[model samples]
Target chain A: MSDEIVELTASQAAAAVHAGELDPGELFETYRARAAADTLNAYLWVSDRTPAGPPAGEPAATSSPLGGVPLAVKDLFCTEGVPSQAGSRILEGYRPPYSATVVRRLAQAGAPLLGKTNQDEFAMGSSNENSGFGPVRNPWDETRVPGGSSGGSAAAVAAGLAPWAIGTDTGGSVRQPAALCGIVGLKPTYGACSRFGMIAFASSLDQAGPLTRDVTDAALLLRHMVGRDPRDSTSLEFPEPIELPTREDLRGIRLGVPDELVGEGGGVQDGVRRSFEQTLELARGLGATVEPCRLPHAPHALSAYYLIAPAEASANLARFDGVRYGLRVDSGADLVSMYSRTRAAGFGPEVKRRIMLGTYALSSGYYDAYYGTALRVRTKIAEDFRTAFQSFDFVVTPTSPWTAFELGAKLEDPLAMYLNDFCTVPMPLAGIPAISIPSGLSEGLPVGFQLAGPAFSENRLLAAAYALERAIGFDSSPARRRDPGGSTP
Target chain B: MLERAQVDHVARLARLELSDAEAERMAVELSKVLDHIEKIRELDLEGVPPTSHVVDVVNALRADEPTSSLPREVALRSAPEPVAGGFGVPSPGAGGE
Candidate 1:
């Protein structure tokens, strides 16, 4: 029973708990055991404390739709008394006194916390190698990366350490890792999930999302995670709760295939290209018409993102100066020296590289040329999406140019590392919702096909993904799902 | 490529104390990033406006209401150096060379 329960998706576990067929405490213990034996290093901090279970008068599992399901949170989201380091040394040993808005809501909905997962330092790196603790290995092949900054969250779900986990997407942090790890990752529209306690990466592009085993689980998690919050002035208010469309059929759904993303010079890998083309066929069989669309400005998205994200990150991360909280290095020479010394020691190489780039971009005379140009290109990218959406309900792309690369392969080359986000960055730049669902395997690894839609079109976006999910018939549980105590193959 | 002097200037503005080696390395790497993003300059932006945010945001002012806030102790809980009910920091002149 424990073995079967461990294999169940979040939705399945929730249903079993709701029906009184599975014990929530037992389920929690099962995940706890799996986490204890985890070889992937997916969790940064695992809570030893067990679930509180139902209150005095209420019956078990009657709490909420997600009641009794165990889930892991990305370390970026603040959990009271739990380490929320955002995978950087600067924030090591730091724990928020209060839970983030999303964390609070998940607890209210009765999803018990298993632990906080690993991530890129300050959610900045493409690979989890930038983590202050260590890199999270891909469960599929240990030598490969699990995609990142949410690599641990994706790896956790892939490794069955947790039923589902939460992640954040800024330039495909959530979706890219989800794709590489062979799970479903949904990045909700900008302002959909309140960012109150989630550590800031790029204020404009950062949005909390879910990395789950399947589309159904992604929708269930999103329903509970999103709502308006007065704390986040950017939070979008819905007059009514966003209802997820349950329609599985894709009849009459029009999916736009971006010509630039799929064209000959798009830099897509051979294996990923084959799987993506097969996915398009699968979509066609599901009664959706795939049309060629042009995002002429998308070629500039990677360029724009590098500037815009770092520019915003430089400002948001400025508060980390040794004065307020977290790690502080004191030189005793002066405040300036203390700040410089603290920051120099606190931030990792990738983080410093970005901060330097951002500082240069936003500095005196260069601001108008670098950041200014990037912002204008960003508008053009959004306009390109706006024009594309007028004719198509959704746009599709190969989630990344290729499958997960080796762990240390791109670490030394910053530009090559940044290119990993080439295919996924445009959606965040446009502030649209997108999901990466496993299309199929390539060279014994998984490839993800991304489905994106206009802002507030999550229901449609998810519906299309669901239809494709059913059509493609992806097995979330691969044969590589290893025992926690065993050495990684 | 960015000059080492330019890297030094940016690091000072960003308040980071880069080592001699790090500044030299940053000069080469940041130059590559800047060159890659120079693709943005290829676009004709005669009438295009810059978008600071994707969503159209207005002030989301709330009712003038007071609510219980995190206690001072709680707020100061994560501070690496805490003093009397707040984060402890060196005085302004303490780090002066």
Candidate 2:
């Protein structure tokens, strides 16, 4: 059963469970055994066991295609009565009384959650290295990191911890890690997925996406995840279960490859560049018109993202004062000291750094100077995409410049790590859909290529990504960390 | 150069107190970040509106409508030290008094 069911794709597992070929109880036990031996740091908090859903013995619901599949939810999602730490000491025992709308949707759809995966404190870092529980070791290699702040989710999917996990991408958090960990991840068009219970990092940039073993499963998970939730007023009113484009042909697809982004010099690694070139060759082979375009303001994306994200983070995180919720420390003789000490100890270094940077950006005298101008730059970047899409259906680039590096290599140097988002960050700022799928392996590490589509073009983006995933013919069949206890990070 | 005083002030505003080493290191790193972020000073946007959000959509929300209650005690279960009705907060000079 473990041989047949354990190796199945999320959709395949569901089919077996639904067909009475696999028992939901045994299936849950199989995943539970795997998670119980977790040393990958992929999980933040895991349940000892999950109840076999529906019929007491058989697969439960008819509403879900992924009804009984075990999956992990990033700790950033609000789960009812479950301790969602948000990878911080602040919310140590925070069990929100209510579940997020997405969680409700998943439960209603009958996808049984395995546990909460780790993330950067409040979804901040590119490398899960920023997590307070320590870095989630890349399932591929013990010394390397899983891309973060959704590192736990990425690593989980990469190592078969769960078939696929739900993740939140704010400023490339989901896709970047997805790229590094060698899995397919999608950040649907900004307002597509409801953000009712996901912790807000940058409200404008934060969108929920799924990480999966393949695009079809990703498409299925995404279908269930999107739609309007009255709880999240920011959610858009989309048709129920928004159908993604299942286009078999790219004969009319206008693929744009920005020469500036296709780094010629030594900026991009040779293997990654070659992999992207090979991917473009596949797209060209598919009869898609591929050409070079330019977005002049593209270079300043990182600078703008740092300012904008931190500014929003500063404001959004202000609600976590040493009051109401989160870890409260009683220091000195006053409310001010208590607040100060509590936060100082509660938040990790990265979260505090952004809070400080954001507090400064949003400060009175600097508002017009820092936060204000970065917005203009963000607008310029968005305009760059809007202009490029005028001649192109989708913009393509390498998901991240380099593969997963050693865990502690860039954590101390903030700028070097922030550059990981050099290419992917701009898309979220434009509120567009971007997907990261395995292009190929560079040396021994995985390389991911992304497709950026204009707002409401998820169907197009998914179709292109699906075509690439099939044509590229990439697969990491051998699970990297079969023995989780051996990993270091 | 940023002084310990300025660092202290920033920390106070941020509700953080950096250790001496962290403060000194932050002073240097933040100065560099500030140098780059200060480019905004040169963009002449006398009439251009400052955009705070990207979607250009207004939040459609309603005033608070209470429906369910947490039975008071269930909500207060996790508070470190709580007053009967609310969490206890220390007043300034309470220790001295």
Candidate 3:
């Protein structure tokens, strides 16, 4: 019975809590036990402190929609008194005195914090292998990676350890891993969620979002996660409260499938191609008019992102000098040497690599050639989305080029790892809203179908995603037959 | 391909210390990434203006009224070396800077 309750979607769990049929404390215990048994290394810290939820049998005291449900957060969001490492050793043993705006919002919504989930160091890598703690294994196959740097969040939800998890998507960190792990991940338009109290990676691109078991939960969680935050100047001021309308049919909706995304020479893998084609047919049956479209600048998006993101990272990461906070190597006699030594010892290899690349690109003589050109390319990419949105309500593509690969497969090859974000990076560059929902399975692994819309069109995007989610009906639960140390088929 | 000396130079500018072997490896890895991203240069972007941000709002500011701030103890909670109610660091001149 506890197992069954833990398997409910976040929306279902919230509904159960609202009805006084389930206790958040009991739910927390079940998840805590499950988290203790987690071989995936999904959680970096599990909170032993129990939260105060509505007592059993009484109606929820607040009008907040989420009732008293349990949710896990990625380590990036600062939780008061909890270690928010952002998966880097630099911030080890450091605890924030105050909570992030998003964290406070979730608590106000009546969601209990299960723990802080693992992530890539400073949310910099695609795979969780870059984490200072360790890589999070895929729940389906323990040998494989649960797509990252939100891999831990994705794995937790997929394995039924948490109903939903909050993760930040800088460059498909949410969507790519959600797709790989057979779940729902939404990267709201940039600035839709507050960035205050979240550790900085690339300030321009960083946005916190929800990774859940289904589209409805993603929608429900997002409503509470978004709003105008005075603390975050980049936060958006919406004309209407962000609401996910209960949508049924997709009649009269226009979904454009980009030709470049599915071209022969592109990155689309064989399994992902088959799943995308089937999902397209499913959309057609749901009354969505699917048409071929073009995003000509997408080919250059990954390139522009590599340069632009790193350049911003170099500046954003400068605050980690040994004096203020975090790990400080004190062997040096002076500040400069101490700064270098601390950073060298604290940051992982990938973090150092990007900082170096960014410094080189932003250097005096080379700025115009690398960072300057990348910015121009970014403008063209945004233009590409603007033109496409004029005709199509949403642009559709496979969330990732391929399903989740084995752990450490591309760790040695930095270029190969960067190529994984080929399909997902453009949305972040354009600052548009996109969601990755489970479309179908490819050789037992989940394949994500992505739908992207222009800035601030999350309502329409989520509605369309919900309609297709029902039509396709891909299972969100991990494959039991592949569970390590259990019975094999 | 980027040279080892160039990688070391960038490391110094970024305030990171890398071993000789790591610098050699970084040069090779960064060159591969650079090779992949070189395709962007093929595009003829003549007059497109750069986009520093996507939001329409610019210069958003608050009034001059002072507000409550994070307490001193809270702000210095994570400091590696806290001294006299603030963070402490080695003197700049100590390392001959």
Best by lDDT: 1
Query: DockQ (C-alpha) of model 2?
Result: 0.45
Worst 10 residues of 2 chain A by lDDT: A54-63
- Sorted by TM-score, highest first, which candidate order results? 1, 3, 2
Candidate with the larger DockQ of 2 and 3: 3
Instruction: Give a tens-digit lDDT track for model 2, residues B1-97.
Output: 5566776777877777678887787777676666655654565446565455555567667568877767677777766776887876677555322
Among these predictions, the greatest TM-score belongs to 1
Give the CA lDDT, 0 to 100, for residue A48 in model 2.
85
Residue-by-residue lDDT tens digits, candidate 2, A165-222: 9999988888988888889999988778899888788988899899988887788788
lDDT of each: 0.88, 0.80, 0.86
- Tens digit of lDDT per residue, candidate 1, span A365-442? 999899999999999999999999999999999999989999899999999999899889999999999999999999
Q: Which candidate would rank higher by DockQ, 1 or 3?
A: 3
Model 1 CA deviation exceeding 4 Å by range: A54-60, A239-245, B94-97
How well docked is model 1, in DockQ terms?
0.72
B1-97 in candidate 3: lDDT tens per residue? Answer: 8988899889889989899899999999999889888888888988888888876777878667889998998898889999999889887874554
Provide the lDDT at A336 for model 1.
83
Q: What DockQ results for candidate 3? A: 0.77
